[model samples]
Target: MQKKQFKEVVVEVKHVSKHYKIFGREDTVKALNDIHLANDAELQPVRRGEFVMLRGPSGGGKTSLLNLLGTIDRATEGVIELFSSPITPESSDEYLAKLRLEKIGFVFQTFNLLATMSAYENVELPMIILGKLKPEQRKKRAIELLTLVGLQDRLDHLPSELSGGEQQRVTIARALANEPEILLLDEPTGDLDTKNTVEVMDLLLDLNLKLKTTCIMVTHNPDIECYADRILYLADGVFEKQAINIEQTRLDYDKYIEYLNAQTHGTH
Candidate 1:
């Protein structure tokens, strides 16, 4: 693999930290401490194409770190830069909001789609809200995304009509509607059964390999973390471990899960 140039900064985090206020907001709990990140080693700098995983226990600050990186939430201290622009305390919220919409795609665990809307409608919702596409074009693009997620036949199906896996696929389709450079997903397959989990994992892996979309996902499932180019493990608000993909992340993820399960049950 050829080395990448350090000319551009896709995402940079410098000593970024978050502290959630406790009680009525007097005390604070540090969620992240002195976190620093950069794409200096990224070979294929799409200004957007990098897949990284964030893993930790519940409340270990994985979500907090993501929120800061995505600009949905601010850090209590330090700096964050997206596309090389410093996202400091002085950065305007409006600008950050626009950056998020224009450059980032988010996938949540709960499949945050309108219950009354069909899969197509849900997929088009972002474009409609952003007013980035015309009415007819939005419809066309929505269909395209549904087709990409293997939900072409379920375009008109409501959330209630789809199974858990199908609904999650719809959410993934909706996330890709904007053609975002950076994809932020929080526990995407959290509620899935083993089969559905595998299916969703495969879909994400396909997207990463085929599209090379930059993915930053937070997952508690060790089985899912293997699907990324790199995994960062957090403990007590600090990222303490790192793993890089040698072959395919899926194989590592499967083996890791099996190891974990065996350790849990003392079967190994």
Candidate 2:
């Protein structure tokens, strides 16, 4: 197999830490401790179009790390650079918000769709917030994205009317509304079943390959690691190890189907 070469370091983390003060208590809990991504020997700098996975136990700071990367939360200490621009604790809220809107896309585990909105409207919300696209353009793009996620017929369906997987797919479409350079997913398939999980993974892989979207996903399922370019294991708020996923390079829908069949047939 040929090794993949990536150009440009899209994300950089240096000596980062996150802490939260306990309510009515004198002690503070450290969510992350001196995590450095750019200088790590095992984990290379994140590049465009790379599918990276962060796997760890609950409360191990995987979600915390994802939040920081998405710029939804600020770190207690150290620097985070996105697109070579340093994000410091002192960065203004406006700056961070604009950065997130323009460069970053996020999909959460709960599928965070608006309860009252249809799938089309939910997907169009981001573009409306960005205030750059016209009404017609927003509608067109929302349809395109929903169609891309195989929900063309369900655009008028509300969150309550859709299944869990469909709602999650709508959330994914919403995340891509701004055509972000990096996509951050926090336990995207946590609520999905085995079949739904496979479908979502296939969609993510397609997006990564076709759109060249940089994907950083936090997951606890080791089975899903087969779709990652590199897997970083986190433990106790620190990176424990890293491995290049040779399987991801050759993975496809057919291969996954074959694996499923083999497992069903009790074959290794």
Candidate 3:
């Protein structure tokens, strides 16, 4: 991978607010309220492979924040600057859409794969839609990505044929196909089993270190946050606190699962 332009500010979110207008409801819900975060606060520039975790409960603005950073959703008020470019624009929807497709990579909770297509074909769909490469080259690159995700043998398998873990892996491969500078994942392991969750998280960490891809992930799982270099806690649409630990957080994947399950069932 080519070296990224280290910015004094990779992402500068200045007093941003996002509100969703419901069609039937009288009250609009505020997803993000007066959120301010400087990517390079405290004399720290954004380096490649800088991992950040946005931690919050389900109702909080974690997903909304990720959407803002991804440039897929706009804030109702305030400025969002990415790579020194104003993402929260006053005009032009065309520009924002263009930026999202070319600059950012997204891994969603649903996996978002075409059920009819094979794993390799699903991965190449984005390149085809973007017209980024020729058919032959796209095919080759898709195979290469699948191999990287340990899905070399399952490339020709359909989504229905593959396990849920394999499907998510294909989604990950697709996300990397664009070779984006920043990867935004929302609850990537939310649907996976314990073993698969760990495997997926491990793969993401490996990619972060090896490819130097800047990663921003949102999750309630503390174990998942362990992979991050910095953790930002959110509550009631606000940044509550932040923790910076250069070392990985002590993560016992099984223990976390047990705790979560116990909470779910209220078992002793």
TM-score, each model? 0.87, 0.91, 0.87
By lDDT rank, best first, the candidates go: 2, 3, 1
Displacement of residue 14 (Cα, Å) in model 3 is 1.1
Off by over 4 Å in 1: 1-8, 39-47, 251-268
* Most accurate candidate by TM-score: 2
lDDT value, residue 51 of candidate 2 = 93
lDDT of every predicted structure (CA atoms): 0.80, 0.90, 0.82
Candidate 3 residue-wise lDDT, 78-151, digit = tens: 88888788774674787876676776789987889999999988999878877879999998999999999999
Of 1 and 3, the candidate ranking higher by lDDT: 3
Best-fitting candidate, scored by lDDT: 2
Q: What is the lDDT of residue 38 in candidate 1?
A: 52
Looking at model 2, which ten-residue stretch has the lowest summed lDDT?
245-254
Clashing residue pairs in candidate 1, if any? none
- Ten contiguous residues minimizing lDDT sum, candidate 1: 38-47
Stretches of model 3 off by over 4 angstroms after superposition: 1-8, 39-47, 249-268
